[model samples]
Target: MISLTSPVETRAHHWRAGIKLGALCASTLILFFIQNWLFQSAFLALVIVLYLLPGWRFFTHGLKPIKMLWPFIVLVGAWHWWSNELQQGAIIILRLLSMVALANLVTMTTRLSDMIEVVRFLTRPFAKMGFNTRALEIAMALVIRMTPVLIGKGQKLTWAWKARSHRRSGWRILLPFTVLALDDADHVAEALRARGGLTNND
Candidate 1:
């Protein structure tokens, strides 16, 4: 698996996974209560500073996932502009970008095994109630690992569309992207079954 954890280590990498995750959750909740664009913008700036503190390469790598958000950001901004709710749109975009950046910071700093252990600990109560959590843990790990892979595949498909046609790719690549996603999922399921599925002991 391609590890999402950044190769350039920072002080944040030393923090406990549970603590970082707890902080991320608390900050995200607080962002919902904040409606002021000034405050949201300041928070977003603070997140950017946090990224910079990890050094240049680390900062750039942390931002890679955020590139996928531009389409939604543009759409939201355009919608709000049409509705004359630009302030609300700005607040939403800033809040979302900041929270996602902070979350990405946590993911980059924390190891996957550490995160899985944290999830296992959190889900222990449900496990005691006879619910199986191994699948849940595996699913979370797969999401973290596969998101970038899927995004890259979509980008490649878009590029292929552009190469073969004079028109902009835009939504034209959606069908192929969906097909690729389904194919990847099928392959993943087959691989897991071949490996006897993810067990609690894994």
Candidate 2:
């Protein structure tokens, strides 16, 4: 579930992880600052085009995690439609989708170990002070890797509830979602233990 890296290679894959991450940050900041729906929509279109450039398999593989964002998309669209603020909603949703898709694009292309190297570089001072920065590095890796996995679980849980009942699942999925996340965490912990990876001590 935590397979953040895609098998399909792109020119983006050959880019340095630090550069990709830096560009992601810059793009996200730009997206956040712009409130124009047209601009946001353009940005999103560019991201989609980037996804498409790697061919269908890579595009589809990259899109799976992005598709998990539909709930928020629905909520934002509905709320905007209800309040007659569709313009504002369009801007919000477009920004949301564009930033997330770009972030996903970076993760899909960049290797996890390369990302860890970036984290290590950023945290060099902590390591030099005799602090166990390995844990911090691993924690960062887990977050980037598991976020999409958990979101996929949430999407499945939502579908399951919708299939069984007539009402909206809303907050009801929280408990089950938490349980599923914890279960995944347990499995991940076991895997890490098996690899002697859970320790912070140097």
Candidate 3:
């Protein structure tokens, strides 16, 4: 099993792995947006192949966690069945699934530090544009890192509420989530200030 002694180290590892995967995903997404055909097919094929990676069984790993949303998917499928040709609908659905799976893989394998460096380097050329690369990098890193934490918190909160037989009330749960999330945001802002993140004026 993969083991890490600290959250920072874990996040750093994730950042690196994520940047590599995210690069591909981001590039493909852009090409799709721009209708670029040069490598779109290749990227789509890569998306399919990535599903065959270790621990990526669609029915087991992908579907199981989000099984609660199966009804929604079925409803979408039915709607597609009615409103459009099945062939076109199939392509859209498959593309959506591929994008989601690729994103999951990137986030799962990447660390926040890796994301920070990627953003920093990407923004380096913008120093002349008055963009604070450090601040942007830190913000992006924190946002990426918080996603998993927020999900984990939501799950734990749901479980605790269920154990106490609470009705999954929104206000009570949202209170803690909002508070903790704000605290994390504040911490990130302080860290940025300490590091002189806004160095664009210099």
Best by lDDT: 1
| Residue pairs clashing, model 2 | none
Give candidate 1's whole-model lDDT: 0.89
lDDT of candidate 2 at residue 65, scale 0 to 100: 75
lDDT of 2 by residue, 3-40 (tens): 49889978888999999888888998998888898899
For candidate 2, the per-residue lDDT at 49 reads 93
lDDT of 3: 0.57
Write model 1 residue lDDT over 19-137, tens digit each, in one string.
99999999999999988999999999999999998689988888878887899999999999999999999999999898888888888999999999999999999888878899999
- lDDT per model vs. reference: 0.89, 0.87, 0.57
lDDT at 43, model 3: 62
Which tens-of-lDDT digit does each residue in 12-102 have in candidate 3? 2434554565675675477457433334456657765654444344324433333344565677778889987665555555555545555
Residue-level lDDT for 110 in candidate 3 = 56
Clashing pairs in 3: 14-110, 14-111, 15-110, 15-111, 15-114, 18-110
Between candidates 1 and 2, which one is better according to lDDT? 1
Please identify which of the two predictions, 2 or 3, would achieve the higher lDDT against the true structure.
Answer: 2
List TM-score per model, in order.
0.93, 0.80, 0.59
Worst 10 residues of 1 by lDDT: 1-10
